[model samples]
Target: MPWVFLVIAGLLEVVWASLMKESHGFTRFWPSLGTLVFMAGSFGLLAVAMRTLPLGTAYTIWTGIGAVGAFLVGILWLGEPAGALRLLAALLIVSGLVLMKLTSGH
Candidate 1:
């Protein structure tokens, strides 16, 4: 399903983002290569999902998932700040994504 591909793409966003950090400005060979591969795959999946899913809704969900997932990864793995404001912002993005999904009826 398109939604499935979108979810996979979103997860790949998280993967690529984490790998990017490890890439160190593309100086690290392995992580940089991994990041490139994942980024391409993520976009490929997004393109596939767009075939069936509404562009606006699918893009919103994909971006929302990626943003929240990346933020959590930063906080948990990289010791980035996870303050109340950040948590609330992440929750709002999730809420918006859920609302979009609910309204889309798919």
Candidate 2:
């Protein structure tokens, strides 16, 4: 289903983003290649999902998932700060994502 593809795409975005950080401005080899591979996969799935899902809803949800996912990844695995403000921002993003999905016809 389109939703399935979209969710996978969003997850792939997370993977690629993490890998991209590991890539260190493309100075690395394996991580840089992994970033490209996952980036392609994410884009491909986004295109597939877009065939049915509305552009605004799908794109917003996709970015929202990626942003929130990256936030968690950064805080948990990357030793980034998880202050109350940052946590609140992530929660707000999630809330918006839920609202967007609920309002979507698909």
| Model 2 local distance difference test score | 0.96
lDDT scores in order? 0.93, 0.96
Per-residue CA lDDT of model 1 for 43-97, tens digit only, reads 9999999988889988998888889999999999999999999999999999999
The model with the greatest lDDT is 2
Give the range of the ten consecutive residues with the poorest summed lDDT in model 1: 57-66
lDDT of 2 by residue, 13-102 (tens): 999999999999999999999999999999999999999999999999899889999999999999999999999999999999999999
The CA lDDT at 28 in model 2 is 100
RMSD each, Å: 0.9, 0.5
Query: Top model by TM-score, which number?
Result: 2
Off by over 4 Å in 2: none
Q: Which stretches of candidate 1 lie over 4 Å from their true place?
A: none
